[model samples]
Target chain A: MSSKKQASSQLRVGDNPLVKWLLVGLTLFLTAILLVVPLIAIFQQAFVEGAAHYFNSLLEADTLHAIGLTLLVAALTVPVNLVFGVMLAWSVTRFEFPGRKLLMTLMDIPFAVSPVVAGLLYLLLYGNNGWIGAWLYEQDIQLMFAWPGIVMVTVFVTCPFVARELIPLMQQQGREDEEAAVILGASGWQLFRRVTLPNIKWALIYGVILTNARAVGEFGAVSVVSGNIRGETNTLPLHVQLQYEDYQAAAAFASASLLAFIALLTLLFKAFIEWRQERQEATL
Target chain B: MSILIEHISKTFGQFQALSPLSLDIQEGEMIGLLGPSGSGKTTLLRIIAGLEGADTGRIQFGDRDVTNLHVRDRRVGFVFQNYALFRHMTVADNVAFGLDVLPRKERPSPSEIKKRVMHLLDMVQLAHLANRFPSQLSGGQKQRIALARALATQPEVLLLDEPFGALDAKVRKELRRWLRGLHEELGFTSVFVTHDQEEALELSDRVVVMSNGYIEQVDKPGDLYASPNSRFVFDFLGNANVFEGKADQGKWLNQQASLQLPKGIEQQDGQLYVRSHEFFVSDAPTEQANLPLKVVAINPIGAEVRLELSPIGWQSKDIWEIDLPHKAFDQHGYEKGQTVFVTPKAGYFFADDLAQPTPLHW
Candidate 1:
């Protein structure tokens, strides 16, 4: 009976190793096919013609303008989102006030709403004869088919990223440290700049990375409000779509490759920031 | 400076954290608020430090009413239980935080702040750790750094809540002695809150035993220990043998047992009390005072042997404890379940009047 029990235990333990390896192999296979294969395909397509052609086409005026506009949007949206996101996070976590729950739910609305709905909502509010747009149009002020319209859409799309990242972190941190600072005679501004800022610095950085990535990659929202004006409102993602529609295969793939490269860099940055934060929290 | 606390009360929702309590703290005295958890020791200390506000009361610190004052404006130093050292700052910077908060007109120069920080660090014997962050230090080191930080501002009063509560046994013992020495050297008016009876007994100039948001007794360490004003203080301070017998005129009687009442216990009910070490074995009855007893358990604890005796006259499991020296036990050769007569030491008073239980544990 003992030998039979030992044999069954041995079989059970032996079966797990094979199962574990099989699961690991399955994961690797899927990752290779889904992510790596597409990346390799894009790289192959970019260099199919020639490195010289790829390099020459990258510096084209249209491509340059599209890249510039995408960069401009990311730069504009990230800092504003960073500040507002931190303030909202602070309010939700540090202060108790009326309508706190409502404010929190409102902050998360952008995350749950579809990007298409977001763009459509902006159009309804800011279009030529819609809501406040008619009054602006009477004064010859244009929002739709403009950079301001594109920026507004990008901000709306990326707004929740920073605050979402910070809220949970600030909540976990509580108000003990800030209270300690206050009791130690630190002024309100000094308490924020010193005690509050340093603690949430990494989370804020992570949020900014997520915001900038989304802002750069935003296509649905920008496409609707930008009116797809060539060389003017044509951001990189929109430019890639335009190139694809125009049947400029190589150029389309080339710009798509650039967008993918930027995304890859952002992902790598996000990973690094997360790793550092984990290390800091472990030490704490 | 005298601190007069008048009917201070703090209530959180339906639960009363501190009731209408009044106390007076004399200047240059190290007072200990001794109690168990949730006994309002910490709440009282925080109220004194201006970290907490009493719902209905006034607090006078040296003729200046500080009931509504902010913690910083109270000019009081508070050392928290977990040390609460700011992790981002170096030891010197942590100590210098309060000093640096001074207005620019009254702020000390860089050299003076450095010198003072170093001086405080040296006082805590942690000058070597001045450059290290709080994360790099051990629990004991962190506590010392906290003490130094609290002392940096040179406040009028110092408050410590469970100063050694987070430390290990050996470190806590060493720091207890070290803290006593520092308190003596500093000569600051300090009030420390602790649940450890041994800590309060060993360190305080005056120990105030608190229970259920009220002060049970306040006296010097030796006086409180020798004659605890309540049963809670007695049990909390040390072990004792309590006999619940009534003193009728000059004799005490309960059930079928009877013994002569001591001098001070003539007028009290439940009037028999004896310290563990006060009882002694006697084969024959003593002329004036004696009791017949049976040894039920012999518990030897290091150099002292605690003998538990069952009452011979009383028909119950009422056990009395007697602590004899190891040599005395060896000389007597007493065994468990042995019967003998014992006489309590002379002048041992009946403590029935002070045997009321307080709602505090140690």
Candidate 2:
């Protein structure tokens, strides 16, 4: 008992040895079973036949096209969500108006609703038979059952990440610095460039990273809207499912492995950016 | 430049933040907008700086109507309460921001801008920390840098919202003296908002006291101190002990306690306000006065010894506090639980619902 007392610092709460070991043991055990094992299984199954088979499966035309289409959707969706997210965050944080609280509550809709439901909603609203889509169909435009539909649903599901990361930060920093800049005779553009942009740049970057990660990995929403087209509309995750359903387990695992690798990279970027922002605030 | 404000008022939603009011400020004079929070002092300062527009009336800066001008075009310097030095910029860059943002046709050359920033830095006496980011500087240093940044464009008017409010007492005092000196040297029209009465009295050439969105009084510091026009001003300016009673045969009495009203005062029921330094404590009640209090606490640590007393027979809203000079306290050798009679040397008496207080002295 004396030894245990000496081992634990007084500053810490929940300092019982048995409780501490139980919590740590449960966390590590659950992580290995739920997360680590699945990640390892993806790579093992992908290379089970042989490294040559795994590489050849990845090099197939449909797989390559899926990868290309996923990248394009992410590239397009990220910038669209980035602009929309920043504008949403900036408006909610910086301005006061009627229905502002309602607007803010509305921003969280994508985050709360199921991604598949979000996709279905978009399909109902923007499909060829849908109200707005009927007009666009006459003009020979197709948003659903295509790459544009995939990108649209992807953008919807990913829009909140950037805005969610930024609102608290911008609110904490407050409008004092911007007001000071304005009083110092800075034009609107200059105030944003010289004052507002620099402070929020790190959080902005962090948000963009999360948005990209979600765009690349989104499956449920993209599935409902994508129509499962083979080479033209299949994203990485949708392609993985198509491969598995076609009895190509190795190809499915290979595609899933690529997603796991991207997720790992995104985590690394997120950690580094969080550390940079911590240092920035510590200095302040 | 002189500033003339006419019938300026503002409302947010349903709350009237400021009532229509007007004042003229002379060039090179320093004015303090003194009021408690929600009294609209900060709102008025922001309005004058063009950071917030008044819902009605016009503002003129020496004959130029600035009522419709954007904050950026008003040509006034403003220092925020938090200093608001750009967190990402070094001290030099912060001070240079005002000059750097000027239109190219009017902007100074880079070398000239650098020199001007350095000169302002030297003026604030922290030129050596020019390379340090705002976070690296102390609170007092950051405040000076904020001032230098505000002054960089050489605007003819300066506005500050609680300039030294974030600093410790010692730092606040030091900066108050420094800012006053800078104001004298620059000779610009200056206005600052502060709820700290000592800051207002010590630093302002004149103080404008406001309450509930109304201007209560505007006078030189000494005159304002001597003659507060309303109850809000009287209570806000200092710690005061109040005497509530009715006049009977020239003596104002509450319960068994009563005191003679000075001659030439008409008979009326009202509350009397007295400062701690304006009354004296003695062993027995005089024929003209009887105010009995028991000392509950004695603190002898500061400039004067302080005593916390409670009324013996009369009623008071709070515990009465009285200050005594150390020499007198030592001579009297007062102790806790000792009863004493207090007599008023002077006070301001307000009649029922009267706006002005009648000054009384003995």
Candidate 3:
């Protein structure tokens, strides 16, 4: 026992034994340089005037309107995308039909296409003098350079985020559970509600949170369509860009800090879900 | 009246899964559909469970023609090989799921549903795991919960596909007996599919042997083992020594060896299969009436001895297997690479149908 203890003590740091701490030290060093320094810099730059001035600047009329529009767009886009994402995941995973592969490829088009290019495609379809735009303008149904146009572009740009997260998850959880429920005399609706929904609920919620974050931060696509009407169409990202152009750096960072806080909350929620799943697995 | 299938045929694209199959299952009879992989046993069970449809067939359950009925309307319970329990729901909720589907007027109250779920959990010996999720249970526990869930709705027929195939050897044996006891107690009309013949012969009241999309034979376990109808059925059910020999007036000769075939065999140029246990090895000249064999290898299993034997010119030929009781081997004291005389009692003979050439392969 004494020999074992002495050997263990000798095998500690700088003992030149088989075990080494070089990898751990290198990882920590890299993370501090690559991530922590920049985050600290951003926080210091944003909070230079402390909470008093920061709160006052955020409460300004234009800035407040921009934040409200950003939230409204996210609230509209997240739930809509959640429902469509689940439906799309179900169809792409469970069924076999003509154009199935094409549908799968089309779901990823949003990720591959640039945000500016996406806004341009909708402009081609709904802008005045465009194919569908001429007929729409005749009936006084405006889309481009309006609230509807901003939402349309935002949906196009962030459409795949939710569905993409759900497809692989739904595919891994195949028809087994649903079939078991049906064998238990469950109706289609009951099976979806009780058995199917509970299994994919976490992934679906994570996808919605991420989609909301993406929707709030989107600037190029929304700016192309919003026309930057200060109080009406300007969302948080556009408002920040406008502030930077007007040389109001402190106010821009202050608003950017709010978006950053939301992003941090989303990350925390995702990490909590993953940690819970891991804990459950460890118990099993 | 129970369930009757008439002339069922199914094909997935170009591959035929089942071909004009017909079977009848009696009420409260626990029958097993025994076959290897891709032998259409699972397909037949799926068709009966309403999980799959036969291309051209009529299924009658009592007086109802349920061939085209939806799965939810069939009222049949199916247990998958993997158990297929919902990983998110607790054990009680998984069992009470079917009870929750009844109409409001006909449905049981929440407390009543709880009592029924508890009763089901007790039946499967899983009452202690009532609140645990499926991922939290062992394989045996999951299977028990799946069985309880299947029985929850009081289904007319229960179908299981390789119920214990995924379990360890010891667990599989224990569950086989447990399942048998459960069937005896509940008297459910069950059809279980498995590739293991021992499992089929042990658990089932009657076994249906299938191969290549067609059922070759169906009979009681003891009778099916003593006498199989075809070479495929015989070889698949157990180990056998198959010989392709010619008949000359009165005696059958081995194809490439000098040993005379067993007496009382039919005078036909066909294949003959004899169970390994039916033949006994003895010293040369000790039994003049027995056929001479050269023992090539000896492998001792639990209580039996597997002997790989060869005839006179057995160098370039099929090897014959012989299984002897450990007591018999110890009593005779026959060592490997020694000459021995063997005799097999005449039981059955069948022509090999797999010898036929396929047009598609050509």
How would you encode candidate 1's per-residue C-alpha lDDT over A184-251 as one tens digit per residue? 77778878887888888888998998899899999888888999988899999999988889987778
Instruction: Find the 10 residues in a row with the least total lDDT in model 1 chain A.
Output: A175-184
The DockQ-based CAPRI class assigned to model 1 is acceptable
State every prediction's TM-score relative to the real structure: 0.81, 0.97, 0.90
Q: Write the per-residue lDDT of candidate 3 for residues B9-62, one digit (tens) a residue.
A: 999989999999898889988888998899999899989888888999889988
Tell me the DockQ of each model, to 2 decimals: 0.35, 0.87, 0.63
Worst 10 residues of 3 chain B by lDDT: B353-362
Error of 1 at B235 (Å): 5.2
Off by over 4 Å in 2: A1-13
- In candidate 2, what are the lDDT values of residues A119-231, reduced to their tens digit? 99988889998988989999999999999999999989998988998899999999999999998888889998999989889989999999999999999999999999898
RMSD of each: 5.4, 1.9, 4.9
Q: Lowest summed lDDT over 10 consecutive residues: which window, candidate 2 chain A?
A: A6-15
Q: Rank the candidates by TM-score, best first.
A: 2, 3, 1
Which digits, one per residue and each the tens of the lDDT, describe model 1 over residues B54-139? 89999999889888888767877788887777778888999998888877887899999999999999999999999998888999
- The predicted structure with the larger lDDT, 1 or 2, is 2
How much TM-score does chain B earn in each model?
0.85, 0.98, 0.90
User: Which candidate number maximizes TM-score?
Assistant: 2
